[model samples]
Target: MAKNKLEISYEIDFELVAINASVKEYKLAWMLNKSLAWNLVKRENIELDFTGNKALLISNYLYETEYQTFRLIRNRAVDGEEQFNAFIIPELKNFDYFIMLENESVGFDLNAFISKIKEIPFVQFAVLMDAAALKSKDNLIF
Candidate 1:
């Protein structure tokens, strides 16, 4: 029997406060990119703000799989829209300190990935902004 395959679309918006509080965008991006890489969450997009003691990081991640359905559904429910509108939108339009990173992945574990990202030594606080899942129908056979 063939296993069922699903294309899962999801985004994880988070704020990562640097331990030093004065870290540069590139440095912060590097730290986050490495952490995301470890967790297998593709870094679809990344934005960094260093204006204050707690810098913000918004990252979008996606993956295609057949073995992880429950995890995907659960991850799609993390909320942070208000924060995105208030903080992310302005920076996105301004393009002031935002940096877009390469997207890559290895495995599927949404919750574990978030937890791993939070474990990074330099990251003071990491909060989930928002997450949602969408199933692709292009490959569906009737």
Candidate 2:
């Protein structure tokens, strides 16, 4: 008798940009909206619960069009009790925020977008990141 095997794989079909800026999350989102003409609106906070009752509340801003979706998320979550910072992607803690773009069309240019983001006065720098290379990339699915 022969047995069938099944394997599951997830495809990360989005573009990730790591942004390093000293401004607040809402201010950064507003800057992006003003600079790029993107209508990123404030959305409900994303809550992630971990073991030992650890929880993280991350701020997210979203902009959606017919062909694409954009999310600007803050990277660090401040702990009220301990006065510490917890990062979304622990390996990339240096980045203050992350911008995720999910495009259903092929016309979107990531390099050009990054360049434009770098031009913003509030943005210190922005760089494209490979999602598949991160160990905690699964945290981005939300």
Candidate 3:
């Protein structure tokens, strides 16, 4: 008899932006909303359970349009016991937060969007991140 195997893969179809800022999550969201004319609202925290029963609750804010969905997530792990391995994207630990953009429509300029994020007074810098190249990309499923 032969055994069967199964594998599942998730598509990395979203645009990721790493933001380096010294402000709180709510304040950043509020600034982005005001500056970009977006309606980002606080949503449920993203709970990620790791090994050794450690769970990380990351703050999440969301905004949606007819052709796109945007999610703002904190990089640091909140309310988690894992000190060394705390970041949601461990490879990009220096970043303060991430903006995940799911663009369903064409003509979306990611660079232009990044420029807008950089215009925020509190934001030190913003850069495009390649989700497909991240080693810990699985953690971004939410």
lDDT of each: 0.34, 0.87, 0.89
Model 1: residues >4 Å from true position, as ranges?
1-22, 38-86, 89-107, 131-142
Candidate 3 residue spans exceeding 4 A from truth: 1-8, 80-85
Better of 1 and 3 by lDDT: 3
Q: Per-residue lDDT for 1-142 in model 3, tens only?
A: 9999987678998988999999899899999999889999999999888888777788899999998999999999766455435889998989999999987478877778899989988899899988999999999996
Candidate 1 lDDT tens digits, 4-113: 99865434332221122134434554565576542224443434434454333444443323432111111111235423332343322322222222232345444565
By TM-score, highest first, what's the ranking?
A: 3, 2, 1
TM-score of structure candidate 2: 0.88
Q: Which segments of candidate 2 are over 4 A away from where they belong? A: 1-9, 78-84
lDDT of 2 by residue, 30-140 (tens): 889899899999998888777777877888999999899999998998446732457889999889999999974687777888999999887888999999999888788
Best by lDDT: 3
User: Which pairs clash (backbone N, Cα, C closer than 3 Å) in model 1?
Assistant: 80-129
Query: What's the TM for model 3?
Result: 0.89
lDDT of 1: 0.34
lDDT of 3 at 115: 92
